[model samples]
Target: MNVIEMKTPKFLVGIETRTQNSLEIKGEGKIPALWNQFFNFFKIDKKISSDIYAIYSNYESDENGQYDYFIGYEIANPDKYLNGDSYVVKQIEVGTYSVISPINKISENVAYSTWQKIWRMNAKQLGGERLFHTDFEVYTNDKKNGQQSLVNIYLSLKK
Candidate 1:
């Protein structure tokens, strides 16, 4: 895990949902449906980076509680897409992050496994205390035929 500082707020444009970790563990989560919405229903207005962001924010308490999940792209235009229908804009506030890059590559299944590995980790393994406010996974544009080869999981950390 590597700690990095984000000096500015980053904006993401796409679909969102409120879910709990328990729901996801049971495989009855809305996040899967949410991803389908992103690929099938999401409209990309402006292009910035091809990296796909799976952002977790607005925590009710922590990883054990309900929080907002968003899957989208970093957009160049936020004001134009603020109609508030199905599309929503979320701003990732500036903070410190512990970035953990999984040894495995992309795929929904692999992402799940990575989280499983993380959950099994101890406090010393985490490097620091977790904030769980705006943790996210970045699917970098390093693949062939519209596939990503790596996913970097960024966990928000307490100062």
Candidate 2:
């Protein structure tokens, strides 16, 4: 794990989808469907970045195991790409983040296991309070065929 500061001056423009479920339910099946739509849009639009991101924000949970989650990719330009319906823009605040690099490439299981390990770590050992406002996973575009890739998971930290 490493600590780094990132400046996100531009908007993250992409399609948005919501899921209401418990953490135990792992309703991440919607993610791949979103990605499929994104890629298809990318092929036709040719305006978005190939680098994908899965952003988890607006976290809310109740005693009955219900929560809300948003997932999308970073777009190159919002004004041109945003359709004002399914596609939307989110302005990310610049701040410090605790970055975790998974040992193996990011797959469904790897992402789940990595988050499990992160949740199990001691708070003091984590070096900062987890700011649940905006935690995200970055998937770069340089992945080689059949080769394992490293994923950087950025956890927002309280300033």
Candidate 3:
């Protein structure tokens, strides 16, 4: 494993909306189910792809649990609105991030371990107080195609 120090720029992504107020800083729970709930609440036709991209807070813990962060998913077209919706869509700005690339089955462990590695590297971590600036996981395979997947988990940092 390699720990790289990078001064990352800001980035944007498209996301599905969610009804529940619970924010998922870590990708611990079922993702597909969450997406289903988001789509159902928005009443938008489900997209064919099974991927979701959004901006979120980053947190690290000893027990490997959820973090206290507020996340707003990026919608494709902010101008377009669904019925019965009163929430406003906005763009989330993430400052810097530590991108961790790991293989499929070992992604979770790898992500946490990478945080430790970062801690050891003499750089400042998010430190659990303020919400993480950015966090994301990249899946490089399709479940339907039976292809091997590689997940790259990224943790955003403070400047």
Candidate 4:
């Protein structure tokens, strides 16, 4: 695994779909549909960056022990995009983050392992306390032939 520190700028605007429970999480057969919907809705609008993000804003479990998850892409102009009731725009605050890239192919097993490592690492070992407000996963689309893609998980940290 590779860990590094990075200063990220605030995301001015983006479209998102929120899920309250782990069962309804984006990758659990929802992210593909959400991405399709988002692209179809914003077909004419150009994406500001190829950097897609999955933001975890809240981890406080509800009555059912579930957290909140938001999956979306950053946009250059919010005014140009049309909004609907299902698709809401969000503003992400700027912060310093601890970015971790596990040296494994993008798969459910890798994700599970990476997260396990992260959770096992405490604040003292991580060099700061987790903000837990807006941790995100940065998706990279560039993939070589016969190679698996990699995701960089960003954890919000406050010293």
| Candidate closer to the true structure by lDDT (higher is better), 1 or 2 | 1
User: How high is the CA lDDT of each candidate model?
Assistant: 0.84, 0.64, 0.43, 0.62
Tell me the tens digit of each residue's lDDT in model 4 across 2-49: 344554454533445555535544356454566676567644346676
Native-to-model Cα distance after best TM-score fit, residue 120 in candidate 3, in Å: 8.5
lDDT of 3 by residue, 77-156 (tens): 54554333444343435344556554445444564465455445444343322224446554456566576555565565
Score every model by TM-score: 0.90, 0.75, 0.43, 0.68
- Highest lDDT among the candidates is held by which one? 1
Q: How does model 2 fare in lDDT?
A: 0.64
lDDT of 1 by residue, 1-159 (tens): 888899988888978999999999899999989988888887775659888899999999977899999998997668877877878788888998888887765665888888888888766687778887899988876757456468889888889
- Between candidates 1 and 2, the one scoring higher on TM-score is 1
TM-score of candidate 2 against the unseen true structure: 0.75
Over 4 Å off, model 3: 1-50, 58-76, 82-90, 104-131, 140-146
The window of 10 residues in a row where model 4 has the poorest summed lDDT is: 61-70
Worst 10 residues of 1 by lDDT: 140-149
